[model samples]
Structure formats: C-alpha cells, structure tokens
Target: MNTHRTAHRLVSRAATAAALATALGLGAVHTATASAPSAAPLSVRPAAPGPDGGWHQNGLHLTAAENKKVNGFVARARRAERAISPGVRAAARISHAELVGFDQRLKSPDSLKRKVATWMLESPGQTVDASLRKINDAVRFTLQWPAGTYSQGVRTAAGLLSAWGNDSTRWANTWNRPTGYKAINSAWRAPRSGQLFEVQFHTPESKAAQLETHKLYEEQRLPGTPPERVRELQEQQDAIFAAVPVPPGAERLTAPARRLPSPDPARRLPAPAPAPVG
Candidate 1:
C-alpha cells in the first residue's frame, strides 16, 4: 500500500537548494505539502510540517535520538502485527467465502519503515510513540470488489468489521473523503496490544484508478511544483474518480460502534492453529 519516499529524497534536496536560490532572489519556489501512507486513507491535503519534529527532511536522515525512536516504534508495531495477523487472515478468508474477488494484504516491513520515517519528517511536533499510534497502516487489508458490486462490498465490509471488532476496537473511520478521493479507510485497536491497524474498501476499477494516479500524487508532493500544477493534478485525479460509479447506498456505511462495555484490557486471543503441512 506504499511508495515514493526514498525516491523523493533527491527531489527534496533539490527543492532545498531551490529554496536557497529563492532566498538569494535568483527565483521563487513553492513549498510542498504533507502526503498519506500506502494502503491507507492516503490523502493529499496540504499541511505545514511541524517545526522541531526531530527530523531533517534530507530524505529522513534522523538524529541518533530520532533513529532510536523509529526503531522502538517499529519493534512494538511488529509485535502487534504478529498478534493480529492470524485473525486478519482468517477474516480475509471468510470475506472471500462471503463474496468473491476480494484481495487482502499486509503492508511490508520496508514500506512500514518508510512510512514511519516520512511521517516523522512531515510531523516533527509529535514524538515517535504518538506518531506511530496515529499511523493506522502498519498492518492493513484491502478488499477490492468488482465494479457492479460496490454495495455488496460495503455490506461485506460491515460484516468483516463486526467480526474483526470482537477482539479489537474501532478507533478511526473516514467514509466521507473529499470528492477527489474514492475509497473507505478505517483503523482498529487490536485487543491487549493496543496497536492500530488499517482496513480499506475499493472496487476493482477504483483500485486500478488509485494505482494509476499514485505517481501524480508523489510529484504533487514536491515543494517545487507550481501551485497551478498542483491544482491541475488534483483535478485530473478527481476526473478519474468521477468516472467510477458509486453503488447505491455505499456511502451510508458507518464506522462500527465501539464494543459495548469495551473489550477487557488483559484479554488475549488463543494461539492460532498451526498451518497445515502441504
């Protein structure tokens, strides 16, 4: 569900140089905005990265303290990923049984690391602990339905969300993304571990459209891109999503309600069954 950070490091340096040039009155430059995660409720809204965010945006070259912070968060998140992975896979299997063509995947460790590093660079005000908690895609699943079954996909999503929440808590939901974005994204707090993970719903066509526009998103994140070009790219993305038909009642899906009485903090899932030897 992610990409472009490593690739953009050099571009960022060039932008820095351009900033220096502008200070000398050689030319003017436009600063870029914050971007979202891979396999996430990845948004392209403009945000000023907080000062003192402990990141030197020279492509995520963190100070020793900041590096330790990222490593600590990754270690904790990996354990959480292991704890919920079995249930997540089981849920995916049940989803396929309920309706065909749904695809599920977890974000790769490298991708997670990149997301964390870049997020810190974009938000210097938060400590790594707080930043990681806010990142919901460390473990994520994508459910892709065919074009005509958007409504059915949303229904399947409701069932999956209900089951997944038995041992997890729903902490975030964004069904009403701006018109330019075309997907449903949510996060849940895993029981006992208290780590957050992401869930996304997409139609086959919409998924393809997202992949098609990913590069544009990267370029739009560059500080040197003229403001007009940024606006143009957003319009292009909107047009692509506009062509995707919204199934009746798809927008009405709600974030699952918090569990009644809440899940016990000390509760733990039983050990997952061993995989069958093939």
Candidate 2:
C-alpha cells in the first residue's frame, strides 16, 4: 500500500513538473535562497476580481491539508491557462490563495512573526530584503510538516511562477534583483478577504532563497548544542512568541498594523497578459 501511495505521489509530482515546464518554457530554474537579510510577509486574500481583474486575499492561518489544496490549486491554475488564460494576474490570484491557506496552517506563528519583525526592523537593504527573509523563514518552517504560514508563502510564490508565465522584471523586484525581466509579480494585488498576500519576487532568486533558508533551519536545529547556546535559542523563541500578530478574527489578538501607503496607478496597471493566439 505504501509503495502504491509513493508511486502515486511521484506520478502526481511528475505531471505537475511536466505542466510547469510546458508553461515556463526554457526559463532558468534556481532553487536557492536570496541574499537579503530581512523580509516582510505578503498578506492577501480572495474576493471578487479587483481593478486589475485578479483575485485577492488576506495572508493568515494555514494547515497541511490546505497545502495539498494549494498544490492542487497550482495544477489547476496551469490547466486554467488553456481555457481562462487568466494570464499572470489570474495566476497571481491562485498563488496568493495557496499561500494564505498555508500560512494559516502554521503552528509557529510567534516564531515567524518575530523573525519577520527582526528582519524588517534591522535589515539594511530595500523592501525586497525584508520580503526575502520572510520567504526563507516561511519555506524553512513549511518543510517541517505542520509548518507555519510563512513556509506556505514560499511554496505558493514558486508555484505561481511555475504554473503561470510572468514578467521577469517584477519577479526580480520581489527578490531585490535587477529590473529587466517581464515577470508576473506585477499582476499581484491585495484584497480585503480570503488568504495569502500579493507581492513580488517572481524570479529564480526567490526560489533559491527558499531552498537555502530551509538549509539554515536544519543546521540551527542540529543536535548537541551547548547549554548556553540552547538558552540563547530559547530566548529568541521567546521574543518571537511576544511578537506574533494576532489573527484578524482572534478575540484576544488586537493591535494596529501601520497602514501601507496608497498604491500608485502604475502598480495597479490593468494590462492582463493575454495568451498567445493558438
């Protein structure tokens, strides 16, 4: 039975891979973490199509079951290209949904919140730096089975690009890279409901950052740390615990997040990437 299940899983993964290859063409596939120091969690959710004709959602709570759902969602998104041809913007919607579902599933919100805050506060680079750190942290945690929302965010981001062709430039901005590629990150937008936040990093570096971050988490958790070292780790954990963002609907969680500046018209551009005439 186990063998059969394993085979099934392999086949599913292969199918997904084949679909991605067909969609992305010869784009480089880099599965390493970015070089940024801090990152912000992209928060979004699902709702009626926004001004740009993309689905939107909020970023929060996730579960393992939802992760699978996200995977399924990506596969369907790829298939959608043939019919809806939703373009990168539509793909953006699918990506955010998968991630929001994942983040809400996390068991370590406090830890993720702390790491995100620290990265956002102390990181010396641009906004992308903060985003990269958060993405890495999220990816690392997700690998642990019942991982956190941040982890799911990483997965969702990669899946979006893989399933939907995007402009490279916008994707690069999400990772704080160069500004040449016409990527799908431009199609992202945030809505007031649902899960997952829309942001950038549709490039190869974003994927790299996720893989590398997972390695860091494994190394830090390696066995046989000195007592004092363990204490330090514990302290970091405690700090994170203190900084968790209370879920929006949680009765006990109440605090105001700084308001984001109004988005520019350029960021809200509505040119959907129409499919090639087949």
Query: Which candidate number would show the highest TM-score if scored against the true structure?
Result: 1
Question: Candidate 1 — which residues are off by over 4 angstroms?
Answer: 1-59, 97-124, 164-178, 261-278
RMSD (Cα, Å) for all candidates, in order, is 18.6, 20.3
Instruction: Give candidate 1's error at residue 170 in angstroms.
Output: 6.3
Report every candidate's CA lDDT: 0.51, 0.31
State every prediction's TM-score relative to the real structure.
Answer: 0.62, 0.21
Worst lDDT 10-window in candidate 1 = 28-37
Q: Native-vs-model 1 lDDT?
A: 0.51
Candidate 1 lDDT tens digits, 67-152: 55655665576556555544444443333412211122344433444566666667777566676666777666565555566555
User: Total backbone clashes of model 1?
Assistant: 4
lDDT, candidate 1, at 12: 33
How far does residue 49 in candidate 2 sit from its true spot (Å)?
Answer: 38
